[model samples]
Target: MPGPSPHLPSGPRTLPGEGRTAVVTGASSGIGAATATRLAAEGFDVVLGARRLDRLTTLADSIGARALPLDVTDEASVAAFTGALDRVDVLVNNAGGAFDARPVAEADLDSWARTYEVNVLGTVRLTAALLPALRASGAGDVLFVGSTAGLVSYEGGASYTAAKHGVHTLAETLRLELVGEPVRVIEIAPGMVRTDEFSLNRLGSAEAADAVYRGVREPLVAEDVADCIAWALTRPHHVNVDLLVVRPRAQAAQHKVHRE
Candidate 1:
């Protein structure tokens, strides 16, 4: 991406999030939490949803937003979460994670199943439920917090990479399906984001997680990705930022990361 040109508008003349409700899934921690906070600051009536109600509620209270229990993998949970919402102007599909790093030869079918369940199926479920409310908003935004892994393949990353690729295409197909609707489908794909629980949860150990970013001086953090999300969303309604791929300076590509 290139730097903003002087000819472009300095900022949105009207606040897009004002007087509107935004729902953020996976809001209990990491990029999800950061995004929820950023959206709240942007003047959206933000709703935080995750399985961990305690952390979700705490974060919501601190940010002046609402918290609700949500397990996107569970049909009942998703149904309940969507039923509770009265209105939705923005749907931030950030409730996904990578579960393993293994080659196809040593594939763990269960892990692959879990990864797809959360990343692809779960996202589709929640988005489908909220499409009506978003359409009714007159100006709606559907933002997918995707990953650079979605765009590029790598060794020992079949499960995660495949799932994220589904997300990438999902965003593409959605944009085509709703061409003239008063809604925007946006996807934020971040690379080398060093969040607290993302690697830890995937690798199943703290030391293993630390090693993932050990040599990097400044890997992208949760807040960095969150900033990109909020920036893309706060743009003028007509200015549809279809996809934004953000990565730290040290990371040039999935296979190329400067580690000094």
Candidate 2:
């Protein structure tokens, strides 16, 4: 007996939709917001997730993307964020930030735990909860927004760097595990990005945050990272960009930055 053909007469099946759908975490500001906007411009219906409802709503309104309030640390919030979506072609896990900077010797255990809560556990929870939807989509693309800090540590950034290293490893492992599935996992690691509130959010003080990059010339911007993410997503299915690390020319590495 002849087996049924897996191939179709016309061609291999593609996602049967005009506009693709994407769910972007941390979409209220910075790289998340910029990526959501870019996806919309590329004809994707984006779902914006963040802890800030007002900011999410405002950003969604501007980009015509749906808004969902999500605290990735909370399992319930993670469930609701993925539950509301019928189909999500792309998942951008970007809802992480550095906690207060303190040396390991003086580090508060609670602060260290908080960083892990948001960066490591948050990504894991969200990704697991949405795996079914991603598999269902048949054109699933998962993007993890990592940092150069993961690759190389800096002084006073032990917790943040450690958390990011976990994210980087997760992305790598996922790529291996999902090889049989029709899903692509990628990591976008950025150097110092000049965002409005990144340093402020990381350091817990606006003045202190400003001081870190005050004299640096032409650091990478939020849009730059966003653009890289969009580019990776838009590539043909046969081409899988495994890992991309982007940094400004001024930034050679975490340990080396030119300040003039």
Cα-based lDDT at residue 86, candidate 1: 92
Q: Write the per-residue lDDT of candidate 1 for residues 203-259, one digit (tens) a residue.
A: 999999999898898999999999999998888899999889999998899998887
Indicate which candidate wins on TM-score.
Answer: 1
User: Mind giving the per-residue lDDT tens digits that candidate 2 earns over 44-81?
Assistant: 88899999999999999998889998999998888887
lDDT of 1 at 45: 95
Which residue pairs of candidate 2 clash?
A: none
TM-scores for all candidates? 0.94, 0.92
Error of 2 at 251 (Å): 0.8
The TM-score, computed over Cα atoms with residue i paired to residue i, of candidate 2 is: 0.92
* The candidate that achieves the highest lDDT relative to the unseen native structure: 1
* Residue range with the least summed lDDT across 10 consecutive positions in model 2: 9-18
Q: lDDT for each of the candidates?
A: 0.94, 0.89
Q: Which residue pairs does candidate 1 place in steric collision? A: none
- Native-vs-model 2 lDDT? 0.89
